[model samples]
Target: MNAEGLRERWATLTRCVCDGARLMVGQGNYDTYVAHIRKTHPDQQPMTPTEFFRERQNARFGVGGRGGFRCC
Candidate 1:
């Protein structure tokens, strides 16, 4: 591959690795979240990165008494 193409591939691979690590640690991928929201929920506003992080933490730990047993 050309230099630019190799650089792009390396960047993509690095991003995927970082995203996976974040997921393993219970941190959501903000960019992916925004992309999905724009594609699937175009009329709704996407959350700021801080809001998204808080939401993910709440969902993972069931905080704020919003609901119990989210999986159910």
Candidate 2:
């Protein structure tokens, strides 16, 4: 019921997503998860596999290509 508890619960539910596994719906509950994503990212278009992978990499660790880390 606390912040940590809530985060842990979310992490548990999203373990497969965190691990970069393609999403799989189970027990007809896929809509719930997709809805969660839509709610979180209301304005963003869904990314393709290449875009998603690139963005995911840049978000956490920052990627090399695509004008990353410009130094003047």
Candidate 3:
């Protein structure tokens, strides 16, 4: 492969690794979400980064100000 192709592959690999690490730590990958939304729901709007983060946090944890995991 050419230098450019090798660099692209390296970059893609690096992004995947970083994304996986973020997931492991309970963080969201906004770019990936946006890409998926754009590809699958072109007519819909994507959330802003802050909104996306909040949405993800609420989905993972509990929504109310109560606390962490909810069992109801």
Candidate 4:
């Protein structure tokens, strides 16, 4: 286990943990979303990070315009 090998393994583990955490939350998967847009709608562009975050937040909390889970 050299320094370089240890660094690579740590980076990989960090990436996996971050990805898993993202999935656990309501935030959408950026890579998968981009791939889907490229495959399905090649002409259209994908949402930017800010736009995507707002969209996800809106979907989860229904803050923007659309309605989400309501506990009335």
Candidate 5:
């Protein structure tokens, strides 16, 4: 393969690795959520990143009196 082909392949691999890492760490759901909103709720605007993070945190930790069971 040519040098340009190698560089392209390397870039693609690097991107995939980074995306996989983000997904493993729960930080990559924002894109998926945005896509879902666009597809399922075309009339509704998607939440901003900060808003989305807060919402996810609240859902996971039961913030604001939502009563998520705390083991600790």
Candidate 6:
């Protein structure tokens, strides 16, 4: 959905009929948000020091994908 569609839906959910909190829960939708979180973590076997260093070097840094530049 577009930004307007998302905002419209958020508005609807946040408006209450009897003065109760419209945004009742912290998350907008339980299943959609939870499933999103579950999709990001990958399963792998534990790594040795050398292997761990290799993987760590390859991983992105900062908030997203800026990348790691320092050595241990």
Q: Give the local distance difference test score of model 5.
A: 0.81
All candidates in order of lDDT, best leading: 1, 3, 4, 5, 2, 6
lDDT of 6 by residue, 25-72 (tens): 211333333455557544533455465444444542322455544334
User: Which one is best on TM-score?
Assistant: 1
Badly placed stretches (over 4 Å) of model 6 are 21-72
Off by over 4 Å in 4: 62-72
- Tens-place lDDT digits, model 2, residues 1-72: 899999998988897464445322112233454576689988766555465555645644434554534334
Which stretches in model 1 have alpha-carbon errors above 4 Å? 65-72
Per-prediction TM-score: 0.75, 0.30, 0.65, 0.66, 0.59, 0.24
Least lDDT summed over 10 consecutive residues: which range in candidate 2?
A: 22-31
- Give the distance in Å from residue 1's predicted Cα in candidate 4 to where it truly belongs: 1.9
Give lDDT tens digits, candidate 3, residues 10-63.
999999999998787566799989999999999999999999988777866767
Q: How many clashes in each structure?
A: 0, 0, 0, 0, 0, 1
Better of 3 and 4 by lDDT: 3
lDDT of model 2 at position 32:
52
Prediction 2 TM-score vs. true:
0.30
**What overall lDDT, based on C-alpha atoms, would model 4 receive against the true structure?**
0.83
lDDT of 2: 0.54
Candidate 5 C-alpha lDDT tens digits along 1-72? 999999999999998898888655445568889999999999999999999987766665678888654667
On a 0 to 1 TM-score scale, where does candidate 3 land against the true structure?
A: 0.65
Residue 72 of model 3: what lDDT? 80
Ranking by TM-score: 1, 4, 3, 5, 2, 6
Model 1, span 1-72: residue lDDT tens: 899999999999999999999988678899999999999999999999999998988877668886633665
All models: lDDT? Answer: 0.88, 0.54, 0.85, 0.83, 0.81, 0.46
Model 3 clash pairs are: none
